[model samples]
Target: MANETMLQAFEWYLPADGHHWRRLQEEIPIFQKLGLTKVWLPPAFKGTGPNDVGYGVYDLFDLGEFDQNGTVLTKYGSKEDYLSLIQSLKEAGIMPLADVVLNHKASGDSKESFSVLRMDPANRQSPLSEPFEIEAWTAFTFPGRRDTYNDFKWHWYHFTGVDYDAKHDESGIYLILGDNKGWADQERIDNENGNFDYLMYDDLDFKHPEVVSHLKDWAKWFLDTSQAAGFRLDAVKHIDSEFMAEFIRYIRSDINPDFYVFGEYWKNDAAMTQDYLEQIDQSFSLVDVVLHMNFYDAGQKGSQFNLSAVLDGSLMQASPDLAVTFVDNHDSQRGQALESTVEEWFKPLAYALILLRQQGLPCIFYGDYYGISGDFAQQDFRELLDKLTFLRQHYVYGEQNDYFDHPNCIAWTCLGNEEHPDGLAVLLSNGDKGWKKINMGTLNQGKVFIDYLGNSTDEVTIGQDGWAEFPVEAGSVSAWVDRDSLVN
Candidate 1:
């Protein structure tokens, strides 16, 4: 199969207008031509209010079809518009992956009295207060759509914990009192802050059988309703690993055997990410946070960073098949909580490292492609990103040969195969303008090449030994292709 790329279709700062779905419908053809095979659409369900970006999930069943959350339509649009958008993507031969927020639920219907114990904010396992009765916002009765797709009403028993205590008028990690309740199998979770299970806003308890069954049932309804090919799970590290694996199994077994799912196992430690993958038997792909951190650190250090060790401890190195690699996303974009924007100068280099190489499946951020709005408005990298995707579609194939001998310069070539003969040569530098002699294979020994990235002006002919010197501008990346292919 050809290399596939997924584009995150929404940014953090997209306007709260109910026309995002329409906007994407029109833009699908443009990105499709640029080789976008998959799209990660933002959560389509209704949230706290009209402006809620779908992360603060109110009702999974009320997918902008019910008159709730102060508006009938979500930030994206109404249910009809969402269904239309999915159809448009399928018509264009692109797989749509819907974002699923199952870790927590927000904007409950009302507060209900529940027993709880306050745990230390830093250490989730350590109890800070004794068991006491507190009024918590853990009741979720979707009054708008009382018994539409699902009549399931959530109570305090459905969740393992709540953040706000309506009784004490305080906010803390209040572990819900239950027959058998605690952080869901701490060993399978990330061992940060003793236990990093509870994130925020009524953490759902997957151990509860009712909660588990409801979620599984909802998955079926969602897929059947939207016709999405897969899901982009939110906050999987905080959720139970065992349940996650089981949930994925149930989906593939009962729903779609080829249902593709990836999770936001948002950790920069590759080993930890792999361990989580192991607990789930490598069931799905995960965001390559380790690799994204590497890009951020390299951009921060510039020439001081080691270009060769870029993929050292990344999911791309450990498990390329299960790595959904990306440079930045909604949370990582500027002004967000996890903002660690890669420098503009290093953006091209970072993209080349992911998009050109035959490793992990590359994901392009919507912010980078369509320019961010609001307080952090910026220019887009549309032209260059489009070209890189074009290369991946037409020229990037075969075996890649690495030339990571230099500290400030690195280059690699994809020796052409029977299918894609005119392979690609990618060279990048973090410091001064550099040149590296890379062998293009004896098959193209006499072919002349030009820098497809427009970073270098000179053309060079490959020697009889199939070696050609490729030039890259300082602090930039250049992609070289056959001059004949460039013309035709």
Candidate 2:
């Protein structure tokens, strides 16, 4: 089977001109040429406003289809434009994964009176104040939608918590006071920021049968209407784990078994992500946040960082098959909330590590591939990204060998499989210029390998023992391949 690669088709600072869907459609041929097997489009829903980045979700059912939320189309485009993008991706043999934001709902239709207990932001498990009555925007009737697809109306009782109190003109984590409304079981989510269940706006109560039923029904409707091949679940850590596991199962068994789901667990600790993986029963893959942090650490440390331990304690190292590895993402952008950057000089090395490796499926960021807006646009990695993807699609297959013993340098090789006789070798250095003797196996014996990256002009010939020393520039990456063995 061919390798699977994903492209995050949008960025945080994309133009809010309601042309993203159309722009993405225009890039289908480029995506195919770059060997992208899947594309994770931004959330197709209506958020707090037309320009909202889709995280401040206002309506799960409003996928730029309804006239609500002060606009008929989302930041991307109209519902018709979104469906057309999906169809175009399918026709191009690329899978479309919709961004699913189920953690909370924002900008309700109306405010309603409700009893609540204020909780400490530091310790969500501890109540800070006695029961008090407050008004909140918990009533979501979606007036513009008006009983079109599903007539499910959301009420205060359908949620567990809210962040603002219209009555008191204050903002705090207010736990809903009712028969069975509370934060999810403390054991079911991350312990950060106390309970971690109340992440903003109106937090949905997954324990509520009606709430559960409505969300599930909405997902089915979304899948059917959008014709997307899978979903990229946002903020899985804040959502109830039991409900998430069930949600993954429902969509796969009920709609399509081949349906893929990539989750954003957003935990820098591999063990914490692993805990969620076990909770979900390994039903889907997760974006490897731990690995992203690893890249950040190495970039900051430079030669001082141990290249041998670059992959250590990362989700990609622990669970490669279930890991969706990436170098940077929307949240990690310069000014984003979760801002953590891998130094610009080290980005090429980072891409090579993820794209050239065989363990985990890789995802390329739009900002890096197509360039971001504003001053950041000048920071381009397009040329290197294109070259790496080309190498990944053509070579970098079959039996793999690792040479990660050095503290400042590491390398690997791929012995060609029967069909693809042009396997490649990759070497990266965090310190000074380095070279390593890698074994390419007897199949590659006597083959003359040259650096595909053009960083080195040396054409090293493999001896009868199938071993040759490949060189890499200081603080850079290089890929080597048998130029004569190429099919073209």
Best by TM-score: 1
Best by lDDT: 1
Q: Any idea what lDDT model 1 has?
A: 0.91
Q: Model 2: how far is 167 from its true place, Å?
A: 0.8
What TM-score number comes out for model 2?
0.98
User: For candidate 2, lDDT tens digit of each residue in 1-488?
Assistant: 67788999888998888999999999998898899999999998999998899999988888888888789999999999999999999999999999999989999999999999999999998999989999999999989998889899999999999999999899999999898889998889888987899888999999999988888798788888889999999999998899999998998889999999989999888788888999999999999898899899999999999999889987778999999999998999888889897789889999998999888999999989987878555376888988999988878788888899999999988876777777799999999999998888787789898888888888889989988888999998989998786547
Candidate 2 Cα misplacement greater than 4 A, ranges: 375-378
Model 1 lDDT at residue 104: 95
Which residue pairs collide, candidate 2?
A: none
Model 1: per-residue lDDT, tens digit, 1-488? Answer: 67899999999889999999999999988978878889999999999999999899999988789999789999999999999999999999999999999999998999999888999988888999889999988888888997888889999989998899888899888988879888888887877878888998989998899999999899999999899999999989898899999999999999999999999999888778878888999999999999999999999999999897888899988899999999999999999888999988889999999999888989999999999877898779999998999899888898988999888999988876788889689998999999998889888889999988898999989999988888999998999999898767
Instruction: Report how far residue 417 has shifted in candidate 1, in Å.
Output: 1.3
